[model samples]
Target: MKKVLIMIGNIALYLGVFYALLYLLRSTYNYEATQNFAKFLDVNPAMFMVVLFTLITLVYLIIFRIKGWIWPQEDKNLFRAAGFRRLSASRVLLMIALGLAGSLFSIGLIVIDDIAKQFPSIPALVDDLIRGDSIWYVILGAGLIGPAFEEILFRGLIFRELRRVMPVYAALVLQAGAYAYFQPSAALSVISIGSGLIYGVLYLRTGSLWAPILVQNTAMSTIFLFKYIGFYEWFGRLGDIWLYIITALCLIALIGGSVYVWRTSGNGGIGEQANGSTKGGLTV
Candidate 1:
């Protein structure tokens, strides 16, 4: 509990610094003003994300080393202790495929939104991003930077720390909830929770942050591609029955693919303990 609290406090401090920097830059450079916050973000989403994530990564490294200085560890690899590790070629490919499957599962959220009429309208910022001038920025921010930072924060630090005090499943669910809430849209929040759970499971099975980060990038990139090409709109025009069937199939694929990836990726590798000890493996 103490560890969890400390971790939360550290995360809050980092977020505070990130937003402060963002506001400072916005005021200093005075990014082009717009009526919609979403439009403002779309104008240079890449610049904002690249700067934000770079700062977070730097802050994490500094604090990680500072903690080492305070405690004086013989081992200097705090990043690995936090779950950052190199992934095998096979695992990398499998993770990317799994990410595609996860995106398919996310599509079900659109169906749910249509049925419930509860999903918030897509933000203008997001709409603008899809149609924005700079494809490079979109690719950089959405495809790479966003996934890297989110995985580092949610999977690398938050989940790793929570697992120290609780069961892996409990930690996964708790972190998924937090991930869901962090989303910009309610519809995306619903989908993100599922994505987070799958990513958590992947991290647990591989004992590496790379798996989740890769999966997240692939999934997000696919979504962005669909949006850019109007594929989502075309798909939405399909008959209700077809949509239902596709949603059902996607759900099955998500579960089946997740389990297969877990088994193939070393059959549930041992989870890391807080003090860097090995523990009993978590199997499906």
Candidate 2:
């Protein structure tokens, strides 16, 4: 119940920002103004994403402090005294394999028109990036920028906090669902959330942020690479039967491979609750 309340507030907080951002991009800023702003800033969505997410995190932290919520306890020590990292090497490999599998699985999601759509302007952003000289946008935005905001906020802040009130598994599942909602992709939403759920498990088991970061870096970079190379259209065309068929087959093969790996090598691989209050049992 506490997590639910936090989820509601967190959703509202982010949703309000999202709508404001939407309005700014659409009604407030005209095309020329938008372009001009993009030009002025090199229009790297990645950089913008970093700033936006960082601000959101800061705001969340502030809310936590004001409400006497003790989260993200400043354990600068964790970084300082690195003990034997517990992340299993086998699990790491499995996660990488799954990352690729997940991307292919998401291709099946393109079967629907609405599911084919991306974050507003993402397609255009891709094209503009191709025609323009915004190298920073592609590299910084996709690789470092987007992940920092989304993962840190959702996985680090929200999921960690939820652990205070619920079982780690429960919090992980809820965050995955929340992540799917955020992406709003058709079939891809499942992939996003499912893979996210696994990452959450890894984070829990490893007791550090590094596990999820590694997985996230791989996933985000691949997506950026797809967009960077102009192959997103092909993936987006998953609406056709052939694409779906091919994707499904590919997923089957990947799963088979993963199962084979698991059997042969042994072992399977493996966010936030909410809002400004941060008062609920959340510690980090």
Q: Which candidate is the best by TM-score?
A: 1
Per-residue accuracy of model 2 over 75-136 as CA lDDT, tens digit each? 22212111112345665665566556655555344333544564333344335433334654
Give the alpha carbon lDDT tens digit for every residue of 1-284 in model 1. Answer: 68768767866866676677667655644444533554545477665687668776777678777777887863345466666655677778877887787665555445344653555343343454555567667778877888888887788777766776788789899989988888887777876788888888888887777778888788777767766776767877776778778777877776777787777766445374335643221222
Runs of candidate 1 with Cα error greater than 4 angstroms are 1-5, 29-42, 74-78, 107-126, 233-238, 263-270, 273-284
Task: Give the local distance difference test score of model 2.
Answer: 0.53
Taken over the whole model, the C-alpha lDDT of each candidate is 0.70, 0.53
Q: What is the lDDT of residue 229 in candidate 2?
A: 68
Report the error of model 1 at residue 116, Å: 9.3
> Pairing residues by index, what is the TM-score of model 1?
0.79
TM-score of candidate 2 to 2 decimals = 0.56
TM-scores of all predicted structures: 0.79, 0.56
